[model samples]
Target: MKIRNIFKGILIGVPIGVTLIDSLGYVARVDGISMQPALNPDQDQTDYVLLNKWAVKSYQVQRGDIIALISPKDPSLNIIKRIVGVQGDIIETIGYKNHIVRIPEGHCWVEGDHTGHSMDSNNFGPVSLGLITAKATCIVWPPSRWQFLSSSLPESRLPLNLSPPTLLYSA
Candidate 1:
């Protein structure tokens, strides 16, 4: 009886915990220095960021937003980067094969703060919207480092065309 009750409790608690983390958000430790000063500022201490799953549910992510996505080259790996260009925008590549690329429909170009160390869209090209998992809203841990991650793209990394694509509606 005791063993059965313990197993039942585990089943209930596990789902609830996972659901909360999936629907709401959760803190994750910063692994690398790709995000640089914005994330793992100190060498010894790693920051924990609050990734907001609810925000990306619609896949309406904007330029400059910090997002977590499944790596195109390897589906099992997850990488965090900033959106440099969205669908329909023409962007200039860095180390990618093409010198210039037009962001495809339902795709976005992403890059890391520490450009050289990170492997982002610049390496594998634009990522499909379906690959995105969540948006990094803020750095929640490290009392002294708490801050909302702003959506600001570096001037040097801005897309060639800043205009939005035209959409036609038919009834």
Candidate 2:
């Protein structure tokens, strides 16, 4: 009878745990060298991060946020990249790279911090917002490196056209 009770607990616990993770967030290991100094800084070790699923549920994201998304070239693969351009923004890509490309509605341009080494918007074009899986909130593993990830974009990487800030009018 005790064994049966233990089995019952396992059955009930598993689904609840899965539901929480699916609705909330989960820890994921960073892979590859594409993110460089920000992520996998040392080739010998890796960083594990908390990927927040709730942040992506609304299909909204800001530039410079590191996000995990389904690979545009390969459906089976998921990749992490920084949002460089949002919908309606035009980016002037590095070194002769320009296509009359304005990020399409519901899409964003993503690229790795390492550049040249990443498989990102530069290779496959902007990714659909639907493909975004999560936003990385912090590094969870490797005790030496634990901190919240903040949104940041390099000035050189800023979009060519940004909506002008609203001006205040005094009555």
Best by TM-score: 2
Off by over 4 Å in 2: 94-97, 163-171
Residue 162 lDDT, candidate 1, scale 0-100: 67
lDDT of prediction 1:
0.89
Pairs with steric clashes in candidate 1: none
Residue range 120-162, candidate 2, lDDT tens digits:
9888887899999999999988989899988999877888786
On lDDT, the candidate that comes out on top is 2
Error of 1 at 4 (Å): 8.6
> Candidates' TM-scores?
0.86, 0.90
How much does each candidate deviate from the true structure in C-alpha RMSD?
A: 7.2, 5.4
Question: lDDT per residue, candidate 1, 97-156, as tens digits?
Answer: 999999999999999998888989878998999999999999988998889999998788
What's the distance in Å from true for residue 121, model 1?
A: 0.9
Candidates in order have lDDT scores of: 0.89, 0.90
